[model samples]
Target: MTSEKLDRRKKYTRMVLKDSLLKLLKQKTFSSITVKEICELADINRSTFYAHYQDPFQLLETIEDEIIADMRKYLHTYNLQEKEDALRMTEKLIQYFSAKHEELQILLNKSGELSFERKVRHVAEQFMMNKMTSEEKNTHLPEYVSKFIISGSIEVLKIGYLRDVRNHQKKWRS
Candidate 1:
């Protein structure tokens, strides 16, 4: 096969694996999932799965890393210098979540099996820390204080996300 065709096949296989994994996550914990099951779902060979990821957990972590990288790009695209910028960022985030609702549903589920919540919190923490660093304030707050505030903000987003999902379900049902 040509290099371009091989790359396309690789991309297709990886996407199938990841999408199957996310669908499985909605039904069960990641720890309970197996590489065999993932390959079965994706209709790929076990050897093919091993070529891309050591196991299911590795695939989960890879997806989380991709999410964080996309979020970082979103953060970089905005100036985020003022409160207005923050609000605008929030809107953009909500839109992003809405578009990726099913995938986010699996990732953001309050399951103890994955550290996705922490990964997202880390992104928010990093964004806040960068914002604070860019501004010249009278007095600098400790990192812990900033982290605490970011945690609170994340909680708010969680609540908003749940509410948004609920409303969407209602509209779908009706």
Candidate 2:
């Protein structure tokens, strides 16, 4: 096949694999998923799956990246400098999680199998970096201080989600 056709095929295969993986995720945790199961679900060969991902975890990473990109789009107003602006961003985040509560639950459950906390922390750090001055960005906050701020916010939202699952209580939390 021509390179162009090969690229198209690869894209199609990746799309198929992604769709199948998402379907499986609704019923099972990420750790229980296997390459063979995904290939069977996608009706593709194991080699094709390997061509796109080294393992199922790589596919999970891709899924998380897509979700984060979508969240970033939804949170285009995220600016940590202005408290009001951050409140709006927090509302948007709460909305996003409420809409995807099932998926987020799977990712945030206490099974210690979840990686979304790290992903959320990374997102928070990125938001901070984007809002800070060059000097502040260069001066790294101590790790504990960093976690104390970001992780504390995330944990509040994480638990608060179980309550109303919408309407972020930024005033109370912040």
Best by TM-score: 1
RMSD of each: 5.8, 5.9
TM-score of each: 0.70, 0.59
- Name the best candidate (by lDDT): 1
Query: In every candidate, how many clashes are there?
Result: 0, 0
- Alpha-carbon local distance difference test for all models: 0.69, 0.66
lDDT per residue as tens, model 2, 64-142? 7877776666556555335444444445555656676655555555356556667777775555445545575566653
**Which residue runs of candidate 1 sit more than 4 Å off their true CA positions?**
1-6, 80-84, 132-174
33 Cα displacement, candidate 1 (Å): 1.2
**Model 1 local distance difference test score:** 0.69
- Per residue, candidate 1 scores C-alpha lDDT tens digits across 94-122 of 55455555565667774674477777777
- Model 2, stretches more than 4 Å misplaced? 1-8, 77-86, 125-174
